[model samples]
Target: RRADVFAMDGDTRWPGGCEGRAGVWAQLRSSGDAIGSARAARWPYEATELEVLGEGDRRVVEHGGFLRAVERFDHRAFGLSVAEAGCMDPQQRLLLEAGYVALHGAGARRSALLGSDAGVFVGIERPDWALRNARQPLGSRPSVFSATADTISVAGGRLSFALGLQGPCVSADTACSSGLVVLHSASYAIRGGECGRALVAAVSLKLLPNATLGALFAGMLSADGRCKTFDARANGYVRSEALSAMVLAETRIGGGRLLAASAVRQDGRSASLTAPNGLAQRSLLRACLAQAGEQRGRAHGVEAHGTGTSLGDPVEMRALAGVLGEATRPVQIGSAKASAGHAEPASGTLGVCKAMLQLSASQWLGNARLRRLNPLVAESVPPGRAGGWCFPLQPGQDALSSAGVSAFGYSGTIAHCILGAGGADAAHERGAGARAAVLVRHSFIWYDDVQPLAQHVEAAEGRTALRSPAAGALLALVRDHAIRGRCVFPAAGYLEMARTASCAADALTAAATLRGVRFLRPLLLDAAEGLWIACEVVAASGRVEITSGRDGAEERALHSACELVGALAPAAVSKPALPRLRAIAGSAVCTAALYAAFREAGLEYGPTYQTLGGAWAGDGGSFSVARLRRPPGTSQGVLIHPADLDGALQLTSLLSPSSGGGGGGGGGG
Candidate 1:
């Protein structure tokens, strides 16, 4: 299911009618397979067909002139050479960050740190830059073809080198499904016990200045961006460029297993080079389903290749409507081409990247544009079905089927694969299976005039603000991301439940003047950023507690927490009713933790140690044994009671350890 990190595919989900049933039946038959040999041939289109809810007739117009569109993220608004050569630069940059986030989420789940990376695998369609670099460097006049592959190799090299990966590096350009194919190679290599993990990148170059405009004139490009698949108005097709990448881990277990995936070749039955072939698509889908088995999520949501051209859309729909009988059919459907245009060589791989978001997000996000499908035709006539051949697939795993990704190349090459959500048990089947907790919350609080207090707070426990439920939930969200990312995280070992604190203008004034704390508004920081901050000492530990987010009597649990180590503060202040009660003795992480988090950041306090000298930051760590410095004629503040004497002695011990004679005698007049 969508929740399984690495699932198996037995019985699978196809569309309906003759097309769907025939395809599925063919797939339910494969042979003995090594760990993941079945994954090698699965096409991107196969996964796309698995759970196709409905079809979206959106034209590739959405991404037209996308080279200059504004970005959706505010954070990335800051200048960062996100794009590469041209229009493709922004798209590639976006894909890189998304891929990074996916991997980061995976690492967080297992408490897996990106200590050092190994290597990366990528798929490049038009390695023009690589060729360009080679041409610029050596002038590609006659014998410069050798640099073509070398230049493209730089794309994959960049990803691995940037992340500091040191393992093997490889790339694939299997036409349209190049992205999934790249993932296929990477996933298998990992499963075959090669590298620890693989970073898969899919990059395609946009049209060069005259090269593209000239291609359109050559009639190779779609005239009006109208990919009318099955419509009579269908012309040719427009080409788009984009870059996408995925981080796949063999040893790492994510939210769900990849289960059974297969992509069979059409042999010679694909009709024409770029011609639409239902039989070829059906053949590949059948092969995948045969290996996957019939499961509820057989055909969940399909990401169709509907380019809105009348001929293309209907032709693809005909294949779809043939499979799903309309009743128990696709629940949701969409198309990335509509969102980002054709993306050419990176098309197949980029589509798969989007699928990851849908599956991983537990939500079905697809193109809902375009007019409804026309209810007609002999092959599409299912007894009773018209809610919408492809509806918006509801978000969630229950609706996910053995996804099918379909890709057709200009060379008459067709590949299809079934991608299903592996069951949860399949993942826990390995390793210790101890769930790890990763937090992403920054609970900072800014105040003025409490510089010393703030310093003391961060020092003792590394905390800056009080605890809140939102902070707790934020930590949970971070954990969720890791679970769904790569699932390669080791059982969590660090209990980093810390808070963040800052000083505002008002509190800065009070602390500088040494005035006591005054009531003021505490600008609570966003509790979503769980302390990634280091504490000067240990105050954060005492105020906040990091547990498993479970509830019971959290005593021993709190005891083990890195943030609950201080209880002395409250204990010390509790003796107010005792008049001049003098000393304090307590055992708790919170008590002494106060001094630890701050003494280094520099906080002042009356000093008396065990007759030994020691300072937190600059103060010497010492123990004192000395007489009290009382007012001349009045013993107003001095209690002098038996307990008070001992308290005074302990206080003195902080400054001096013992009296000169070693005898414990101290009664002053």
Candidate 2:
């Protein structure tokens, strides 16, 4: 498949610990070497399992891929309450995370997805959350419905709802082949013009104790805690946890392509229901090749559904040998399951992701845990090419143009997909410029240690809501900024609030200029208790009003109002042209020292109020740069932050040194 955008989160040694497709791809450059004990000691259930299984058993070791930040969900990012998020499954949480990343990777704008015809197809098989909830005593807490967030159907529907997608939302389960099946379904929907874009996701989380025991009893789990794909030492597969997602759009839409998908089912019967049928796999491969409109020789490689099982590995290889034997080149072959462990329902998506990475990196990944090739697979190996996973590419090697991904469900259902090069640039190349953007480094600086503020914009009527918790903790500087013996929110705070709201609603290329401002009432400190501050876009004239009060159906006091001028303007480049400007003494002091100065001046500036930097008086006026710093648990966006403007405005009072007592209060507009 042409990977216009993909996202993955699994174990890896990347700088950020493999949170995205790039992270997974970087880890795939070499054989997976991150295998380790699953840390049974951390949990009583796993520890008990280990104790019962004994040291000699690989099940005791229980190695598999686990995510590092499973508990760290940004509930506010998805607009879910803490209670709602707690009741939700981690699998659903991960799907939301990965789906959003994939959409952004595909250059799909957030506004477009809202109320747009974008289908969502997700693969999910585990019901660990539901099982765990069932074991708990049904206490006073209300029962959580299986269809709410625990059901597989909600896995896709939740993402669609969160992003306001109106297309078909389906969750598929075909055992290990579920991932490919979901992806194949999404492709058909796109080709059939059912939706303009499709979000396909596969997620697997092994969280319950009973599931491990089931796999152990089923003889499907690796006793040695490794997936030795294509190796003689292969015994069984190791279960892993992962989230893989992709964004698909029709090639005619001018983005990427998921070339072709061919799914087949064993009509009669196999050696057993779980046993894979080689002939069925071969037929599926041929059908996939034909659907891709290419002969065996035209293919570049095959990402086999090699789970390292004693019986399954050989069956998959024999099927590949029979189908790819006629290819012109020694077709490269590999499996991500060897490195990342088998992600069950998500493994098929992981394999396709690996194929895309291989095409982009122009190198076939070496299968991990492969020391000795199985006799059956070795006998079918063509001359010149090593029987095991192919070696890494040397310099100047051409990248593979077409590849095949095969996933066989334990239920005797086989699915194979053929993907060819849709673009010269791989996933990395497509996002290189964005990945290297300076905004990546600076965009997060505006948000402090608080829940990010959500922006709601109705551009049709030129209205937006930038609602957030008030900066009560930032009353340090403004502690002395009072009018009539009452602390008043600084005028600059209003400006920053208005500008930020306007910017969020306007095009990213443009900024807002505040004018026609008026202050209706002083924002008293005590009046803000149990209240939220909001900046609302009032009209088509670009007017934004900052208000504070209780939630809906309550009167909100109008703290300040301003008319916003929205237009494309060149970035500020010219320095301030003034007669004379001087730096405020001790402006370069450390934060503590600056606070000490404020204390000496009897100006009790809190975190947000202490934004004034060096100040100077010259040419019959005073000037200073207000270095507004974000307060703890508060977020700001405008370069000319309200706090900064207030700090700078304070420079005017410096003209009268006697005003240092915080007594010279005047109107600012």
Candidate 3:
């Protein structure tokens, strides 16, 4: 086996922690193979008798091989991963694989899987819980696998559960090509920065009994137990079960890489289940090859389907020959069917695994039954085993193909994956860490019923929303100036400070009751996380006493002295400071409306000390503090700022979290 791609090279093989164990594993696996599958293969291992509970710290296996023991009390030992360990289902297998990667440090299950990022799972779910446990007579379908059969969805959930990723969850129904398509989509997501890493899993479960017989009658199943690709006697396909997984990280490995990929279509131009399209196949091959920089041909080599079907086989060979063109040096080729039968939706994934396996073992395992039929035999399946590929490989070691994954979905979609060597790069751009982005929040809620478009004004680097006004009190002039007229402060009055004072006028009562308002100044909650606010002052001697209202007190009376000055005041008004003093508390009230809008968008706020008369003084009024607390028999111990009580919008007790709900969010007017 070629050990270069994944060998942890003694204390340093994989990107990080996948080493050491690979070494021990390599030795053990070699010994296991040496003993051969002869005796082992005969006694079928039953799931009923054998239980696989993952354990021990030697999870990676030292030098490389199969793990038969449990390390620490990992949730994965229960089945597949931390999420799946509690449940037994087909998804358990995928979870197991995910758990393996995670324990090895190649997994991204914390935030990405469960938080900021999204995920995708591909597979059939295991038998339904109800059906699996029910007594026979009460069961309807006898097997619950039909409805709850696809596990791909659970993969998405498990990944999300482990990683906190939450972008998009999709389960494709592309048949045998589903696994490859899943990988392709995941790669695209990485390139698109939707996620930093993706877990691509493929699996197949035994279908409802007679599903094959039904296919057999439909002519899709080969009556002959064997499958031969590109052979004169080629008939049909043998469906089988297979499971595999490969983690796709956005970063590129240091050594070799899978540069590019292309998927073409046969349109109706190519044959369906019985025929292959050479032209379309070659087009895709060329596209993938073109991505290789200066690489000769489309790939270093190609892996053939070689299902031995008379009609299907030739088209595949012809497709290869067409892609290869006039190159005197023949292209290296082979098949995975030589070992395991075609695994349906997992077929392409299986091929990908074989390609990886070949790169690992440096061996080209030959067809177990076929002698030779194609004229393009420049070298055998193995070049080093029977001493290299001069003829068909006897066994052992040889190079097969650097690229060899192709699949045709019944949906008329065909895809090819280019195999690659491995290593990790720290420089790769990934959208996985902390990201602070601005989201458009409030659009106007119009009384005219017009759709108010949302204006998402982003922070243009170094942008800060300053707290322009926090306290203010409106006074003596017109009670309804805003309804028909606009008011201006006196020449000596600081307009901005007046506005702040006015907004602050209503706050004193609430702040006093709550033992003083403590604004989490400079609140930097993200737009996605929701609304932000802060504070500036404590109005001095502010009292909500009514002095002139004839009825019960609705109009608060902190402006008593100003009113007294006004009444006595033709003379007092002549005083240098009387007009400005009278305007100070009255004007601070006008800032309320403007400040309300800022409260809706999540942002940081800083005090805008805009008083003109002097620096730092409380609202010049006679307000006495009144403490407010949640009344008895109430669960919400909230201190609602009386000034903003009318604008508060409370949410239901329970809410389903959603991003569209706005990250910087809290209900408000």
Candidate 4:
């Protein structure tokens, strides 16, 4: 369930004026034409009335993919004041709204994301809004929020701040390839332990006059205002206005997984600064296929960066053909630009969304408005190449299990990513034997009789035994709480295990408090194969121990030991007064500084463990506020969340800072 949304000016016959995922899909499924005459009411100046010179010929800028009401936004929904919203760039606004919709589709609500470790990666190029505001009347002062609102650098930060995300926030500008580049960066971040999950978004809006004029002067804009990609009549691309967003995470909750590999490369010293390099593109595609390991040569389709430019299309086709030409079946090649127009920086991300849709539906929407195949493109891939390029003239069904997507920047940066359908869906399509083999290999089914904590538990006499598969959602959550660049199981997780074992052994419905808990060693999780965990509890002595080892190993080393006390009675329950502690504290401690100190001490904490929102230190003691960050819809049926408990334990650093040299020292608990 990868959440995705798109705002485009598509066919009016569809519902909601082609404003959502369904609308874009419908447009592609039907006529596959979203390009149309530019509206006079949307732009500040009438585009159809304006003429521009391209290649010594004057052409009217009459066609584009413009949204019906790009100006509409609910300021209150995002907690922005009207004045601030007014000054905010429409790119920023659209990104925020689109991000919310995407997250919601992935089952992450606004309330569930507060203090999340999810990262934000946005790809945006032009500063049209900023340029427009700079041309205000003489003596006009810019608003205080103008810098933040219009600046492209802060676009990702704004979304992170609004969602209360505590992970990495980055904004990239790489000309038209910005979107794919950010997607590449996000995937690397997740793999490199930067964030547990990420939101990748890209937007393009033709709001200023200079952009259009510059493209026209550079002979980039299509005179006919149509992107005839791969067609003999292709001249250039028509600029489009669109925004697309999707969520990427390690969990299977999303629509699909990034095939084992993706690659990014740069063209050095080409014919021109903006010229496409066939060799560089070929190298990039090879690198991506190499990274895919055994999955290489399995691509069933490709969403090409077909800008409809005569030079670019042929070069890209040659590179693609050289790398993917040997497939057993014809690779269905097409471009969304043929229908939606070129969205510039946002084009790459939009192409990814479309590819995902095609993979999910097992279909390919052919090139729109393509009258004839470009002779150069045809010549690039020789007739003898196994199943050469096949550009569909209409929508058709194809078993697109995996697809490749490409985006190249005029700046010479090139990115390519391979995507496979969701595991369950792909396995299903591969047949029952494949599905069973995958289940046996992973040892976990998404929807099984197993509970969240432990998959199986058995109680005999006073001893309790429990076994849980260390993968899927549990693995995803554990990965978020990385320690020192490694996915180490948190101490709180041990407590959770101890409590669960005690309750099961004692036949108690309520969890028992753990006493004398000790983490003997760190449990490191492997990226390829996570080992299963085994817990043993002695109910009579209230003793519990947990351990894990390589699958089918002879011995399992102890990782934790604890004693579970009986559940507390109603009279024994007590609540501490945080306001009283705050009154006694002397000075306030900056949360950011505290985390920085922790990082310097090699106690790195990700977004889930970054729970100390507010802290204060004094001679008497230290007071702090901690918020729990976890996956959405996972807070119920638990005595205490591991993240919340770990956060509270982190306050120990404030009590004995000199031990770790991490600052915020105090004596009182």
In candidate 2 the C-alpha lDDT for residue 399 amounts to 62
Is candidate 1 or 4 superior in TM-score?
Answer: 4
Give the number of colliding residue pairs in candidate 3: 128
lDDT of 1 by residue, 394-453 (tens): 223445544556565554555545455554433443223533222232212111111111
lDDT of all predictions: 0.38, 0.64, 0.38, 0.71
Write model 3 residue lDDT over 130-175, tens digit each, in one string: 2333312111233334333234465456545544457655566576
lDDT of 2 at 379: 69
Point out the higher-scoring one by lDDT: 1 or 2.
2
Highest lDDT among the candidates is held by which one? 4
The runs of at least 3 residues in candidate 4 whose Cα sits more than 4 Å from the true structure, single-residue gaps closed, are 1-17, 39-41, 44-59, 257-259, 424-669
Better of 1 and 3 by TM-score: 3
Ranking by lDDT: 4, 2, 1, 3
What's the distance in Å from true for residue 589, model 2? 53
TM-score of each: 0.44, 0.60, 0.46, 0.60
Off by over 4 Å in 2: 1-16, 40-42, 45-55, 138-140, 143-147, 252-258, 264-268, 295-297, 381-398, 426-428, 432-669
Poorest 10 consecutive residues of model 4 by lDDT? 437-446
